[model samples]
Target: MLSRSTGRTRHVLTISTLGLTVALALSAALGGPAAQGRAPAAADAGWSSASPFAAAGSELSGTVTVPARRGRDTVVKLWLSNARLTSVPDACRSTVTVRERASSVSADGRALTCLVRSTGSRRTISLDALVDGEPGQQVDVTVMVDGRATPLGARLVTPGVPVPQPDLRLLSSPDFLNADVGDLVRGPGFWRPGRTANSTNADYRRALDTILDDWRAERPESVLVAGDLVEGWWGTEVDRSGNFGPDRTLAQRKAALRRAAATYYPQWKERFAERGLEVHAAMGDHEFGDNPWRAEKRRLAPLFEKEFTKRFGRRADGSPRYADRPRGSKHELSAYAWRPRPDVQVLTLNVFDATAGGMRIRLDRPQLRWVERVLREARQDGVRWVVAQGHTPIVGPVRSHGSSKLTYEGGAHSPLWRLFKRYGVDLYLSGEVHDVTAVHRDGILQVSHGGLFAFGLTNYLLVDVYEDRMELDLRDYATHWRDAPDGTRLWETRPQGMPKHLQVSPTPFTIGTAVVDGEGHLLDRSGILEQYTG
Candidate 1:
């Protein structure tokens, strides 16, 4: 039951009862430094086109078009309905191929990599190609599937335009428990004996793969994850004890955390790398043990945070993982900032500060000072957009489901938000709510979204950053799940066990969309987010 309101008519197609598809026709404008104010020639009218591909005995039918067009690279995206693939095949194995007809145009030297993934009954194909031609020249592109040629689309190269900067397509989702107990159970045999095989079911994997495939099709420059990358019970043995007895020494507990980190971190990162994605992740409460931080759990928080830093905050040589971090700060690795584009700065905050008082869901003094410095520097550097992400929301009365409902210590009037208001940070992204809520205050927009994937409430946000404006699209997919059997423990923290099986709808449609100008002004808003704009 995923839906959207775009303020314009949209066509929804139900493909073979597998999923829903929304057809959108958008025009492409000339981009790049030189093309800043130049009008796109009429020949670019078909820079993007969605044409149906129906072949005999073909299980796939949907739109094929060039969704992204950079200076010399064009990304063609193919959406197929009711198509199921046995495995996620490389782009070379895909039946889809792109051919360009222009004298000066030739393929870029890089090898062509395509990602073909099947989720539920839907399938997605993404192909990247270098289309080199003179500016203003019309390049006719055709997509061939199984040797059947279809007029996929055409685009015009702008004259005198310098090589375009990398496209600014960013995809984000939080509370993504990419790990399954089944994955851990298959690893180093650390669990207690006689444990059943609790790996993720095939259906769940398929749904996840499909979602990843869609992300690939979008051709994002980077992916941001707010936190909860795994169902981390790490050092604790609440559900299934390790080979050692339940009452272990401090050293034994530390060793357990290392083993768990070694097993899960690589796999979690591989999911993004294999799809050719660059990800910037923040640490969630799950990284240091789930919420309700009792005395014993609090004692192990530092150990857990160390392991997390070793994996995410540092590189192989023990240097910091992120180049742009809060210098001289204690939480430098956990809290960092980077500029994906010259005009945009993105910062990831580690809000879980394990103080002597308890686990305080607030940025410590060092990190808070660092945040203000970064924002001040961004303003001085003329950065157009500043987006900050943490694990929990700072504004409230938000919805929650299957979560601890942890918010920042002081809500909207907190020091963290006060700094944001002073510096004019455009957006704040957070998760841990297991639901979606949008709040706008003091010229800043806070979006709390992302769901427990196992529970079938998952969603993702796509931000398209342009020269003068940014578009945010919040999309949700329908999912179905049933109760898992007893002893199905994904981790020790969750009282409710993981779902036995989960299936996601093939179609993921937009639930909300918004537009903002360079000055942090809300230019337009629609769908579910419209009500929150005031």
Candidate 2:
């Protein structure tokens, strides 16, 4: 009977630039002779006027105004974070870089971007050095650009760390589950203190406030809410006496969700904007609507899509709804891919669509095919690792008779499990079980973020993927903080195994149930099950 959203947005600030040269010295001068008048105040500078970077986050964009004496060719060297190191030469070109305390120099340019840890409370982003020659040859050095001094002043990093995985500091409640407010009675249900409070009122403001404070202390790069951002399907109906009772009206649910989004998501976005922290997101069951494949649920798709477009800033035509882009918006109904750093390529799949909002999980034929396409592309492009994230746990420790009952009994594996296995998916992250569980089945790692806003226990899982190694940190909310809670260390798995590496498997392991023992047997667990009716 469990349901929740899977995946999250892990923003990678791109350090794109052109022109490259050997390391050059940065002049310790301010506002070079090119300045005819006083430079803009710090407040007026685009950096301060726009959004601020996260704790160790910073962004810079400008052409290196070097003297022509170096050569007819002008090059800028941009050093990105060290963690982005890859076996592929220049694999990090023009893409978002996701690492801390690292720098990148453009292969052909003189721009250098780095995210250094905060000294005291301030993080620094500098055009540290300018190089204007070959890799091993001498190059001219210029510190000041257009009257601006080199290594610009460091400022206070806002919003601090991104909340994706769990740390030892804060706990995250599973968010994207299509749970009714009533089901969360035993724990700290996230409800707003207003009339608009209904099924969609997740008190993210209070919850995130707590998480943000903890991040300020620990300084994580990003935060991940996983999926099920909204309860678009609360209006579905069944029986009144059953726990899956008469659902609310679609209008009612929509209004509640709308209010909740209007009330908090903007603030959340603004908070992220202020810190220049990239907010990573993934589609959940609720994002589309419960039982998305159902004919009735399909009718609601437009409405849900509209709301989603508005929040994510996409256009009506389903483009990356960037304010500066166009009339389009960011609408990813199937699959979206990203790279945390040059080494990590994350593919977010809309797995719920396979069920089409019905009782069975099936990978959309297109997405199933696309998964292979994206993986091949990433590998060809020299991606060091590939991680797939979705909302449902295809494999876990929970055992149950497959039932569509509405209260945490949907514990059977989805057909996509084999697809994941075929791909040798390194990490499968999901939320719905309402309890944190990490296990390795057939060399693939499955992590359930579990549920939050219940029994006063909320949590999230953190994962750090290094070269040939990874670290999983699970953070649960401490009960003391009503709004936010403490996080407990749940479990981790980076065990040695057969080259579960990124090599593509010709065939995925079959999707079936495994014996409680480690027999590695496949059971006929296909198809959605009915809810557990005691």
Candidate 3:
């Protein structure tokens, strides 16, 4: 259902290209407005010949048509032009805007950006109208020119049939591991795994097992792991040089880290692969280095970038698959999107963008603005839920694992957080908070969980998204683990408890019971209901 627009088209005679010519040409050629490409069904939606609209110097009216498919969201595309159409015209002299009839979803501002490829290029602008359709109804679309309120009339033909249910049932939340996903050998014979990184592969492995075991029953199609694939945090290191001085120099350390990453990353991929789960990982704090590594990050940062780009697939230039970056930015793979359901989108961010705000974790302007644009486009696409995941928590108790200051929150004050709240994001997922709890903010919820040091306890959140509200099942596993003199840690079932620091929450009721806008926050404490206390 698209929102209704009114009025008649009366185009302005004088074309205003005062300072827009160069920018318009460059942006179009570089694919800014059309970067995403033509809609899947653009060709199927034909357009009528353009004719001069009444009371306009160069306004040519056109009609857009599409096969009406019932219950489905129909997107119609049309080539816009300012002059009379000699052929299937799409180019226009000034800006063009399209609006549709009223519906459940609508785009804000809803203006289309028109552009030219070269200085005097002749290609027309492609504008798309995504209509939220109703059965047996035709959506009237109005195309306005040069900031005109009234539209040169166009119509949308839809099947108006109800769309089938999006065959989506599961979206897993296993926060993966910290600085390392494997056992870290330390000390003379090796102290091992939980000494400094704050976590062990034992806990991660045990958590993975429990998560997969639940997966056997839940069978999630896509698993959304919240970063920290393997611990290369604090850069890479080698066994101390002979008697315990730093073994590798900065250059050597980075190389060693890259080499380790080349090997360990594939191993990490195998663990998730063996479980047969499609994983979408976000960049976490540990993925770069230890907390406060912001200062020294540049020394070993490229090692992380190389591994990340290699794994996630990116151009050699090191930009993301789908984002525009700011000047002087590295354009790394810190932010990306995953669409699990037709109406739901998962937007992930790397809160450790050091492009600004020295040493503090912030989204920065480029990424922040990119997120705002993405959310805006998502609204135009009729996406119902936008679940944003990042490394640090925007709002939470800074107790053991969370950002300690406002600069890190990315909440109301930060442009990124304000954008999220403004766009009405349903859920904001984060890590760094070892505890598996959900916090309610202005209108959204921040939920996080990860395995604590060793195999003491791990929290995996299972979000079940429905058409109306999202529900969550927080799984806590208190693993049985022991360390051998050989330094290999093992998981057992008789440990029965963890140290005070690694203890799981005692209050099961509020552990993962969260709702958003009286929406997703409603959850039953499964541990209590099943009478399985950790």
Candidate 4:
């Protein structure tokens, strides 16, 4: 029987750049005839160009005149342009105008910006304004061509607080278990004996395509990858004449791993570059190896440093290789923070590159020190949102104890968790166990979605962050899993026994959950669930 969630579900399809172009053109054409009118005297002033002009394909550009400060009636034109796209097509001319209206105030009160676009022939177009306003401020905008009477109106208004970000979509299936079947020579992990339908996997290729499509559609400022790109273990191989790896050189194994990575990773890389999306990845266990104990990590760290720096690094210099984060940086691994927009700060951590292992848990003192300093500086800088992502999760359900659960600070609980509590980390993103889970401790949120290469898996998660809330969406590939007991569908039903600060809400054909709290306690639940075929 098909899962109930798959019966009537809404899938977030990947819409390409071409799709956006069509939408823009259609919207402008449909609105042109309805807006046929002209404004007063400003028409006689002759044609005047807007202050800022966007290059082609730029999603936003244009100018409007507004009072310099609150309470002033005089308005001067302030033009702003975004140089992102190559050029704006002539077809976009009809949808332009000047904007005037009080919109939402920024975290810091500043000049209000409204949404306005260009219209055909009428250079002096009035756009809608939705920025915040202190009393007594006003501006005048005359969007006019050389001689034609341009239509003008102040329709822009402050946008309502954006809804919490939506959850990412995930698609899953029984067939996902077969993902690595024919690619025995690939993947850095040993293969287990199981039916193709029993393996856990994700449709990475499809997900990559969807992400690119979404980026073109939304034009997000930056994309963040939490970690875990490779399996990090020897790939499944046919046992030949009882031969084992005691004789195989590490160098030979490394070479084989690289070949597999090269074969499987090209498509993902091309998709990222083509979209012009700024891509950031946090090194995961798979990128190096699974169960990377502290000692093993110490040894593997140099090897990976060489591999990435010499092989897969990218920078503004157009070099396809890794560059040191900075001179004299103590982070022997690639861990740093970046801000794509003024409102958001992303901190990526290479948690695996420290001194600890299955028999011992230790946070390399230097790395720990660096983390504290970075967090302190970021908070002091008045950064509103901080998102931390890495490969190993500080807390989650794991099956066999290997590395993360082994030892800790002075043989106590892992130090990473304590750090999270102390620094007020907002969200934690990780992948290791091939499962989807949302665990919240106090107000801190940890969203985990791994299992991309289980087999015939087709699933990915969607996350959305809104001003007042955060939303999570888990999408399955072709079908949904249903409750077998009563054959009843589950949708948007809150989970049971959640702490006051933590909450889970299920949605139609999907599981939508939100943990509401500015601060709360997150208990540790470290046992992995037994595998079952339902």
Candidate 5:
């Protein structure tokens, strides 16, 4: 079933299981305009269709739609279904290509062709139509299936005034702990028949992928991850027998840390890229060798910080990746800010300050001063939304789930929260607790959420930033995890190893929601977050 909403009315078209050929034949017999390669009339509620096409003994039905008054970011959606091609034995072997205005739509900054594999009899393909044509011009869309090209439809729409600040859609999930997979550690670990080394649980990857697919379906512009992208026990040394070996020389430990970073960071990055998501990440404690930073681990904090900045802080040309940063500060790369739009400024802070004593979870004076300048400048520049993200929550008494519950030293009374209140920063997104908590204080809304993927409490926040208000929907995926065989070691931490298996429900449902107007006032809220509003 495909549904299009226009004004107050919604038009839905339900395609039957009779297959594409039957549907096309029925439409032709009924004299539907869509079968004739023309745009649907206004009564069709902006839905246009292409003549059905069949290939490789399979049939496909599709539709294309564009808003009547298009803007700079014109969104054209193409929905395809009833596609059954020759099945390949591999996990995924099918490709679907969509073209708009004679040019292939782009995905992941490349061509808009999607590689898909079928898991069921029916599949739905939703694509973003990248149209560059001028307003008042007809935009034509075509879909290529196998070797067949079918004209979806063409529609003429007037272009509206260019929007200075378009609505923004974002997904925020932190503590993604995307551990490495398939690396088998051999040694004298607990012996189980099929158990080998403690790599990422394959079952967990599938469950995570399911959640990622749901995010892709929403077509968010970007994803904001507050921290803990990996399980980072890199600096710790373990013998082949899966036992912690603290006697390794500093050189050996450093080499192992570097090797682990090289091995795991790419996997962490590729997961998001594979889903066609652009991620903006903050540095978590794990990136700096986890918390407590004992004397030995403290010595390696700078190296871990360097590795993180090398991957996330700089562009290909060696210039800083963020537009605004605290120049001359050691954390310039790890802590930075950027404006996604004219109305919104986002800052990601590296709150883990490596002191001679130990690691402190606080924004240092230098970074704090930079943040104040940035926020003051943003307010002066008329930015409507300022969002800051870090690993630990500054407003406390929040929830925790399978987490160390590391937080800023001062909690709500911290200098950072005070600055946020002074600057009227709209939202502070943090993730250390691994559970969802909402604390609105002093005009700033602090949301502490995101869960441990291994523990199966993985959740995310979908935020829609409109001109006058922002809507936040907190979604949680139900997952089941079981203990691995005894004696399984996962690198340095989890000597017995983490859960070897995780199973996630197919659907993630909204557990909490809130609406905040431009003035940072909570207009309404529901579910687990409502209690925190007052």
Candidate 6:
């Protein structure tokens, strides 16, 4: 049910007459960089998304972010470099536009090119651009997409440079089992159900806004949703009297879902849009009626797929964004991949493609085989990193029925896990159990980002990518603004588990970091990142 990426393979470099030492060892307990002896996960093939690192010289570039703060003018620094060029390359000047209009830009190559270190990997490219806008502005910068000009999308401006200055950035979370987040009428569970039962839309918005506020400097590129983006699957909406409500037919439920999409889909879409990230969602159990297989699936499947298509299907120009991706038809909007940058490939899985969790879940042969095909193509495309995302975890730490673990109903050791290892997937982002846990096994990392609907340990993952390494920062949304600037303060909680009786821990929010070396071939240090509290 989840999905999300890395960045460009370019760095700014100048023949550094003054070469200084930089600490390659970021974490304390990490040893020297692991050897790149393992054969490439798969042999490289020609790619559609051009890899600038492939040749000695190409337009090696990073993102240029401009804050869309209407009516005001701001400046942004775009770093660039060409390992093959001693001076400006042929396409050195990339046009800068705002709201699709051309903006004046002046390149400064004197100080920048000189400071770029001699080491090919240690070099950087620098460019400067100015942005002017009126108040309340929301516009885009144009970028070439498949010979077509497309908007670079909006960027939420930030103050200073954030660590792990990656080419592409993303946020991941799952399990949003609610419709009108503000009106998820609480059931007769342990706590009250009504309007204010769990987290209100306002609560999540406010908290998430606070977190983004800190990063208002520069928001991540997009979000990878690990399914369960909605609540109240067909039969789960029964009343206290056990009635399935008046709208019970497959046709009736479809209408209700369409109505819900009108209210709920925009809730998340707008939030993500404002934060400057397009949502690439997954198909969680909730999307499939949560309950076990029934004859109704025949009728319900098409309608459910229709709802997702309506909500997230097309672009403003009527382009079928969802349909354009992988074979997402059966579960439409459920399986797809987007390469934000040539070096990074983002793949989304339909956990409900073949089987819904039984008592435990399986990725049926179709999905498993389909995943392998995608990974193989990624390798053929010269992609250096692959991040496979789904809803249920192949390896999870929490104890929940939906979890795929040794004891959970969602059991493990399926063909999917082996594919992950065989393909050298750097990270498998998942979420079923709400607790934030990152585990490394068989040379692969599985970090279940905390869920959006849960108040307990609600968290998100921020990834920064380099040519040989990627950093996964598990950020706490609740304590992000509450913690001391250093994040040294401790916090605790005792919320009832999703099952209502399970006792939960009171662990304080902390920033967790996991590093992957040589295109995810090795997990450098599977531990927490203590330096950053903000």
- Candidate 3 RMSD to the correct structure: 22.7
lDDT minimum window of 10 residues, candidate 5 = 1-10
In model 4, which regions exceed 4 Å deviation? 1-220, 234-247, 292-301, 309-313, 316-333, 354-363, 396-413, 454-461, 466-469, 479-510, 515-534
lDDT of 4: 0.35
Better model by lDDT, 1 or 3?
A: 1
TM per candidate comes to 0.67, 0.45, 0.54, 0.47, 0.66, 0.54
lDDT of 1 by residue, 409-493 (tens): 9998899999999999988999998877778788898888887877677778787777766777677665777765654644433
Against the true structure, candidate 6 reaches a TM-score of 0.54
lDDT of 6 by residue, 1-534 (tens): 000112323332211111211212111111112224532111111112332122221222332222223333322212211111112211122111111111211112211111111232322333221212222332122222112222122322222222233667766756643233422332212223331234243444555454444433336676777777765354323322111223556555555555545555666676667766667777666666554546555356556666676666666575668432545345435577778788788888766543243323555455566778878888888888888788777764543433332221233466777777888788887766655556667777776654533333345566766766775655443232232254331110112212211112222122344567774444322223221121
Model 5 per-residue lDDT at 350 = 89
Q: Compute the lDDT for candidate 3.
A: 0.45
lDDT digits (tens) for residues 1-534 of candidate 2: 000011321222221111212133222223212233655212112222333332321222222323332212222323222111111111112111112222333222332333222233322222221111222222222233223332322223333223233211111223522233321222122333331222222343344445545444444454555565544443343211212222366665445444434543454455555655555555565666554357656655556555655766444475653222111112343346656577666766555432244534435556666667667677678766656666666654532221121221233344456655555566666665555445566656665554434223344444544343444434434332222133221110101111111111111111011111112222211111111122
Supply candidate 1's per-residue lDDT for 166. Answer: 26
Highest TM-score among the candidates is held by which one?
A: 1
Q: Give the CA lDDT, 0 to 100, for residue 194 in model 4.
A: 34
| Candidates sorted by TM-score, best first | 1, 5, 6, 3, 4, 2
Q: Which stretches of candidate 6 lie over 4 Å from their true place?
A: 1-164, 176-179, 182-205, 211-218, 234-245, 248-250, 292-299, 316-319, 322-324, 354-360, 364-366, 396-412, 452-456, 479-509, 519-534
Q: Mind sharing the TM-score for model 3?
A: 0.54
**Evaluated with lDDT, which candidate comes out highest?**
1
lDDT of 5 by residue, 58-170 (tens): 11223322222322222222222221111111112211111122121121111223333334333344332222334544434433333233333343333432322328987
TM-score of 4: 0.47
Candidate 3, residues 1-534, lDDT tens digits: the string is: 011111323222211222222111111111112313332211112223232122222122333322223443333222222122111113322110111211111112123323222333223332322233343333333322223222222232323223223235555453464434433342122233343332234445555565455554556777776665544543334233221123257765555455556545666666677877766777765566544554456556556766775775454475455443332345345577767677887887767654333445776666777788778888889988888887666765533443322226545577777887788787877766555545656667666556443444445555656566565545444344444455533321112222222222222111222223234343322211111112
- Report lDDT (Cα) of residue 231, candidate 5: 75
Q: Flag the better candidate by TM-score, 1 or 3.
A: 1
lDDT of 4 by residue, 263-334 (tens): 334434455678776566665554554453445345554555445433235543646423323224434436
